[model samples]
Target chain A: MREDHHDQPHAPDHPMTEFEWRVDAVQALLIEKGVITADEVRRAVEEMDARTPAQGARVVARAWVDPAFKARLLADAKATIAEIGITVGFDATIVAVENTEKVHHAVVCTLCSCYPRGLLGYPPDWYKSLNYRSRAVVEPRSVLSEFGLELRSDVEVRVLDSTADMRYLVIPVRPAGTEGMSEEELADLVTRDSMIGVAQARTPALR
Target chain B: MTRVHDRGGWPGSGPIDKSEHDLSWWEKRTDAIASLLMSPEKRVMRVDELRRAIEDMEPARYEQSRYYAKWLHAIETIMAEKGVLTREEIDRKVRELSARR
Candidate 1:
């Protein structure tokens, strides 16, 4: 007999996958190429999730402290956001709706999820749901009611529709008694719903 | 090691095991380009149009493949490279690409 193992077959080493193997491979290659470190990639993803500017908290905080800036934001959301170095006009048309105690504003992308992520970071879970889409336009009051926000009947509900081009974000009026509060403290009170015009911004109770 | 005699069974007579096809660099690049098409604001292409565009861009090897299958793969590949596309830049790029010959 020939002293060879050529007649034997070996199992294949790799199995083909139908998933996004290429993306993972590219990230690995980027790490290897030193273009971006593994830590950098992780941090970037975390930053994206942690505080997307779409909330417009920065704008709200500035508005709380500066009346002139607040006037600018109310006049033009796109220009105001740009002033803060957050690009807002390229993708979705951002409109700034002011919410006061007497009259509240609520925004909805009836056609799609047109949100200002550049200012707010990320859209909340409910913003992307069908209930929000269907109810926001037809019954804004009912939807807001569910979120524990009941508007007085006298208050006009100005619901802004965000289509492909015109995206809107609500600029909530600064809560009372929050005077002398730091920008960070004001930002903390600016919830995602407050920016969407669904609910009023809440402040800490006095001790 | 012990030597063995031929048993009637032949070696390598079974079907050739298919090689795992890793996406090439060009394929990945094409995917990155395609990701620009998906944005929240842009008027997205219809299924047929998307299929046509992908087919036109694909290499000659994949030309005869099923249109829907390949296009689905392209979209899936795009979603994987999530950071590759932004709503604004992609919309502009898509418009520019669409205007091209």
Candidate 2:
């Protein structure tokens, strides 16, 4: 569980801020009023913490190895993922964008940190930064460059802006020279940044 | 006018900070509470309402606030708005908790 960027200033040993105190008070009052129980909150925390990019990596690896599953995923991401036992608890529609030989796709929620949290877990701090929110849509190539991803001139870059009701998952093109690798091995190459389209999947030689 | 929270395509923003830190206990607790409040079974508040509250914030405050802090602020605002909790009660509880520390 990575700490959010703002909470960095006040470590656990440090005194709680007014806002942190308010968070505690809010939970206490909610429980007292029967609005929510302590148990429910604990369970919710565990559920959220359990989700990580590993889930998305598995999905990517499955898509890489299984053509039929890839077709199903690209056609309908939410239902397809649910078929593999990944529950999308939220109501938002997830669209899986594939990176082909001619096109690349990236995702950003310019309005807020709206992401495919149900699939990829909590977004990283940089994804929520104002810089990413502002620039990802306008200058995706340069942003990708900052992440050390240089795409060929022939491959077009399309930045998908996620709204509250819609999200995107980028399925990076499979890396070269792993023709005989199993799904589990391929999953290891699917970095979180690759799924976000800032970088490509790791090549077998690099690994 | 483009709102602060709606920051797409606005120019001159600096480099992104890619560093990550471990979530503090309270931070995780805050996330849990917020998530439960918005869950289907609870329906205490919707995510859209939370986003609206955060967007309605003053620009300077919105820019300065942290990710989960923004979430906390929105949760506080919505809880108060829906009469699920009152601002006075929350403030009083905060004061009481502060004194105990």
Candidate 3:
């Protein structure tokens, strides 16, 4: 009889350790083949880590200054993002959701981390973790609390499930004060977690 | 001498010659295969399930890669083919993919 192991998926479930080993072996083999240099791979990981969507930053900036653009972003994110020179397209579509003080919104790919990457950036480890994925849909309030965001029951907690055709990024309500801030300054106000609706954009603390 | 400049590493970093990296040809093929398999698919999977899918595809030569890699690749390829990723975007994603460990 053939070895059943060949036909079966590995047992013991969620073998992350084994998984890491396979990655190591694959990397080692790649190194042996000269397909990718160690430096290239290292740079790649760092690049991935450092890459935040400046395009996304611009989008938030526009939303802060241009009412028409904000209207367009709310109407259709893909087009509005493109209008601002941030070209967003792909198997994954992008949609911008809004959050007001009275009503807060959050996004979760209860299925996967189906984020608006073109307008966002690298997903945080927490976004891709099982803890966030599983709990967000079932208990939005508790999860938001852990992330340090709490909403009153009167404030609806809308959750959007990112799918193949459409993904979401949250456009938070601009913070109070600082009406005269520059575009770059406003962009600084937009954080990755905020765009994903996990947290709110915080203005600098008062003196 | 005909000038050819390297553009692999991020800005302010030195150039990256795809050649200097010491991945094996077989390993390169594996990486390519991994890259191809790792592109994003139309499927929506839970994080745990996504992890399992990556684990399952790990040894398939062309069928499996880490979950995020394959997922990103598929999305890249599909979008590019559809004119979604665009030429510049494709180049960027390729750089991201190559740089990504």
Candidate 4:
């Protein structure tokens, strides 16, 4: 939901809506009832703020170099991600799907804004969009092309639709010509878009 | 069964907005509330209940609002259902806050 909802009016464009007031109203109610402390709410915001795509980049870079780790990540994504210190929210499971030369994997939460928040941080604005939710499922190739990512025709495009309980992380193929790069350096080539399978990993020149 | 929240692959949907935006102050609070409510240890509200609450809104409202607005609305609805707070209290709080501004 973080993206600019172009179809919707902005709060700045007008006064706060009824629901906007409700957000503040509800928080005040919770604080007064002792259901949740103000500190906890502050910390929750801090927790999300602390996460970044860098965490996901680190995971992707490690997967690129460590065949063993990639195997584990593919087998049991949540656990393997935890081994590298990525912890998803309790209500969800993170699934890692790899893209190879023969098949490309793209992710979409057709239902809602489900995402691998533990790794890539908050879902990007576009990911929560109604346009993306609908388009990515049936027209992934076209959608990817919109992002300027044109896949080879030979590669089969697979769209992984995320659910509330199970989210997906697309492990894009490492770009060629970076044979000796360290994991840290390799991390630099991974972008948030690439991890979501909207774009390819950065080539050496891009890094 | 196809609610407005079930938005996958709907033809003639608006164009996707790829631009990212900063979390506004209230948006941050909404996110925090959602996370806090979903925590198992807290047991304040369940995601299923929240989703249902969101879907229960009129289609026009659903179409007009953004994502976090849905969460905030759902949380307000579900929390009231669970006896955590009443709608009256929320409205009074809103009025009180507005008067100060």
TM-scores, one per candidate: 0.55, 0.94, 0.58, 0.91
DockQ values per model: 0.03, 0.69, 0.03, 0.60
Candidate ranking (lDDT, best to worst): 2, 4, 3, 1
Residues A32-95 of candidate 1: C-alpha lDDT, one tens digit per residue = 4444444444443444444464347877888888888888887877888678776642345566
Task: Give model 3 RMSD, 1 decimal.
Answer: 16.6
Q: Which pairs of residues have clashing backbones in candidate 4?
A: A3-A125, A134-B9
Q: Which ranges of candidate 3 are over 4 A from the true structure? A: A1-53, B1-101
Range of the 10 consecutive residues with the lowest summed lDDT in candidate 1 chain B:
B1-10
* lDDT (10s digit) by residue, model 4, range B8-42: 77879766778999877778779888889889889
Rounded to one decimal, what is candidate 2's iRMSD?
Answer: 2.3
Q: Interface RMSD for each candidate model? A: 22.6, 2.3, 18.6, 3.2
Query: How would you encode candidate 1's per-residue C-alpha lDDT over B46-100 as one tens digit per residue?
Result: 3334444444444543434432235445554443344433334434433443343
- The candidate maximizing DockQ is 2
Per-residue alpha-carbon lDDT of candidate 3 for residues B1-101, written as tens digits (9 for 90 to 100): 21111111112322111122233232333333333233354222233343334433334432234334544344334434544334454454334434543
**Each prediction's Cα lDDT score?**
0.55, 0.85, 0.56, 0.83
Docking class of 2: medium
> Candidate 3 on A21-48: residue-level lDDT in tens?
3344444433444544455555444333
Candidate numbers sorted by TM-score from highest down: 2, 4, 3, 1
User: Residues A23-109, candidate 2, lDDT per residue (tens digit)?
Assistant: 878887888888987778778778888878889999999999999999999899999999878987775788899998899998898
Candidate 1: segments with Cα more than 4 A from true spot: A1-47, A50-55, B1-101
- Pick by lDDT: 1 or 2, better one: 2
Residue A192 lDDT in candidate 4: 89
lDDT for residue B93 in candidate 3, whole number 0-100 = 37
